[model samples]
Target: MFSRDSRAETRADTAKPGAIPTQPPRFSGPIGVVSSAAAPSYQPASPDRPTSILGPDISIYGEQLILKTKGSLLIQGHIEGDVHGETVTVDDGAHVKGVITARTIAIQGGVKGELKGSNVILHEHSVVEADIIQERLTVADGAHFEGSVKKAKNASEVTPDLS
Candidate 1:
């Protein structure tokens, strides 16, 4: 039989540093909010790249990489550079001042440069002031466009000079 004094001594001996006591574990409920003593810091994601811009009428000596995003491309800023992509769409207030090359291009905004694409659609209220080259093109009513379009080249057009 163990006495009460023996149990107290055992508890004190088991309370040594880095030792697990033989007591029933206590459980705290799920954590809700965490408190921080210092102000939070801004941590950017890995492999961060710099974004460059061009002023109007400023000719770029080399290709300016605007973006390679997989999601929607929204440009409220001015771009005096060309864009090449799989699909491109411009919102109503956007103003692009450079050439665009894409598989499918839709413009509901104002563009001041040339455009080349496999399929092009110009929505109503859109305005274009440059030339366009595409395989298929659609211009909606009330859309203002003052550009010449060249249809897609056919096999006979490419196999020329055989007089």
Candidate 2:
């Protein structure tokens, strides 16, 4: 019959040479939850984190639905509203029918409205029917676009206000 001491010895025996020893986590300790009341909420707006996503199963349609975020957003659904973010991407098979304002906008879906961004990209297999105001614009081969594109003198001119 095995005892507690034997189990400890077995675990110790399994450790590799020069490897750092590990201790069991203390589950009895109080766990902290992220809350707005305790600390200021920090929204990460960086290339490492694609902070938000509208999944393909989601569909938002209303008179005026405004989605605003300081971070990056990936939309793989249908949205009939305005989107404001630092970086906004409309994924393949997605459909949007409103205005999109961001620092960077990449569309691989169907959009039928206005787009304002410092950098705008229409990928192949994308269908867009919207006026674009951008400092830099890229339209790939096979991208169907039926709208006028206006260039901005400065990148800040096309960047959306994240306030």
Candidate 3:
């Protein structure tokens, strides 16, 4: 066994007070100490999926109905009764004669009745002859719209882009 004095001799010098001891260089590349500043702050954008504002499933009466869904309803038929939904869409080939109440209504067809919605979009192929109440409305070029529209809420400028 070595004596305390001999063991002390084996050991080198100690670090001075208040002095930080240097660490041996690591074999791996520089270790990144990730601070909050190194990382980017991020916020995901809201999805464009249209949510249902009101009404249940769609209902039709005595009219040829061809329906497509993209978080909205597409109607290609002759509607007699009242039509209601969150987002109601009518194709250019459709011919409807009824009252429609919805959150957002898009028409590329021929409609002859009263229409109510928060937002209304009429395409170039549309021919509408009805009184409309909406927050926002867009009518495309060549679209024949013969209706008085009442703005329900403050909205952006109207555009003539049917599709």
Which predicted model would earn the best lDDT?
Answer: 2
Best by TM-score: 2
Off by over 4 Å in 3: 1-71, 153-163
Candidate 1, residues 21-75, lDDT tens digits: the string is: 6753221111112122322121221233221222233333336644343322334
Candidates' TM-scores?
Answer: 0.52, 0.68, 0.51
Kindly report which residue stretches of model 2 are placed more than 4 angstroms away from their true locations once superposed: 1-50, 153-156
Error of 1 at 16 (Å): 51
Q: Higher TM-score: candidate 2 or 3?
A: 2
Give me candidate 1's TM-score against the actual structure.
0.52
RMSD of 3: 26.0
Clashes of 1: 0
Clashing pairs in model 2, backbone N/Cα/C closer than 3 A: none
